[model samples]
Target chain A: MVVRVSTAPFDPGAETNAFLAAGRGAGAAVTFTGVVRSSPDDPIIALTLECYPELAINQLASSIDQATSRFGLLAATVIHRYGRLTPGEPIVHVMTLAPHREAAFKGAEFLMDYLKTDAPFWKQETGPDGTHWVEAKAEDDAAKARWE
Target chain B: MKILYFAWLRERLNRGEEEVSPPSDVATVADLIDWLASRDEAFALATQKRSLIKAAVDEKLVAHTAPVAGARVVALFPPMTGG
Candidate 1:
């Protein structure tokens, strides 16, 4: 598993290509990208993400380890970016490779769910009104609980 | 020991990190939070919603009941909204 936490934006296509190239024998691959969203009602200008870098990396690595073991994944990578991001920009990318399609799909979803609840990155949304911190959703915690 | 705050907790406290000795009575994370809250009004406000607060010891997530005695670094923050 590879985990990257940075302020720089990354190309999801390129990341997927690189990951696929390395997993030669893996029969299935799944990839997911999370983007900063803005709605017509809210009209957000940007999203600012703050992170505890050391802890984020450590927690992501541990989550990846659990995903791999549970799903029998051959390879996985998670790249999460912090700092201010404009709407439509990618905020996170997750890719998983496994011997079978079921494992590949489930692994990616598992990692994404864990990231939503456990990763130590906080988001603040900026808009015409001003900036306010995003609240954690109850649905997200429920999502994570399913895996346990 | 070093204490770190992040997100709204950092905003409320107006500082990201601080060093302090909480005496021997602060044996657990819950005890530590109560101790910190007593230091000032800002801390009291920040920790007002204990259920919304999360903690880490030496960068690893732990429960409020977790021991804080030997920890060199402890972080307190709001529930994560990442990914």
Candidate 2:
């Protein structure tokens, strides 16, 4: 398992390929990439992700452990980027490898669900109107509750 | 103990972190919030939104009622919005 909290942009394709290669025996591999979204009503020029780096890494490591044991995953990786990011830039990437497609898919979803609410990162969107902190959605909490 | 703030809390508090030594009566996270709220207007305002605030002790999320007696680090922030 690999968990990285970085401020630098990364190549998702390269990371995916490396994970797939490392889990050569795994028959299924699933990857999820989240990108910054521009607001339709108001034009968001950039997004700033603020986080306590040490705490963020620790939380993500625990998440990987939970996903691995619960889903019986062969391998997993999570890369989350903090700092300013323009719209359309990659914000986070998750990849899961398992012997079966079902496990791989479910594991990826589990990681993403946990990361959405459990991670230490907070997002602020900056646009023409000015900057505003993004509020946590109740839907995200509900989505995570399904796994409990 | 080290007190850390994040997101808008950090911005509103006008600082990110500080070392604090609360009185012995400050035993729980809630108690710490109450004590902190008395420090200044910014803290009072921030703690006023208690329902919207989330906290972590030593990097682990916990309830406001959780014990803070032996905690080395405490973090306060809004709900997470990451993926």
Candidate 3:
């Protein structure tokens, strides 16, 4: 298990290749990357992800532990970035390895679902007009509830 | 104990964290919020929508009713919107 909380930009391709290469017994590997959304109609200049690093690390570690046990994952890596980011930048990356494809996919999904609603990070978007904190979506909460 | 705030709450409160010492009767997280709201109108306004606020005690997430007696640090923030 690996969890990274960083402010510096990271290369998702490198991360994916490294994770895939490090796999030993697992036959299935899944990497999910979440990128900042850039809309033409509602263009954002920058996005700020604010977090409590120590608390975030603790929460993420526990979440990874839960996903690993629940899905029987062989290996997992989660990298979440905070601070200022531009449109199209990668924000979060999740990688999971398991013996079967189903477990690998589900484990990554579980981590994303948990991070979307419960993790200790808040997103704020700065657009042409102004900066506003992103509101939590009911749909995201519902998606996480499905796992329960 | 130390208290921290985040998001709009941090802006609304005009600061991120502060030291606090509540009365002995302010036993629970809900009680602490009530006590804080009573002491400052900005806090009251910031927490007007109480259900939207989430809290953590010593880096561990907990509900509003969680006790605050033994906590060394308490943080309050809005719902997460990160993936």
Write model 3 residue lDDT over A87-127, tens digit each, in one string: 88999999999999999999999999998987899999999
Local accuracy by lDDT, each model = 0.96, 0.93, 0.93
Query: Residues A8-115, candidate 1, lDDT per residue (tens digit)?
Result: 999999999999999988899999999998889879899999999999999999999999999999999999999999999999999999999999999999999999
- Each candidate's DockQ score against the native complex? 0.94, 0.84, 0.86
Error of 2 at A15 (Å): 0.5
List, residue by residue over B1-83, the lDDT tens digit for candidate 3: 99999998999999999999999999999999999999999999989999999999999989999999979999999998888
Q: Estimate each model's TM-score.
A: 0.98, 0.96, 0.98
lDDT of 2 by residue, A92-135 (tens): 99999999999999999999999999999999999998999999
For model 2, what is the alpha-carbon lDDT of residue A32? 99
DockQ of 2: 0.84
Candidate 3 residue-wise lDDT at B38: 99
Q: Residue by residue across B1-83, what tens digits does model 2's lDDT show?
A: 99999999999999999999999999999999999998878899977979888899998888999999989999999999987
**Candidate 1 DockQ, CA atoms:** 0.94
Where does model 1 exceed 4 Å of error? none
Error of 1 at A121 (Å): 0.5
Best model number under DockQ? 1
Residue pairs with backbone atoms closer than 3 Å in model 1 (clashes): none
TM-score of 3: 0.98
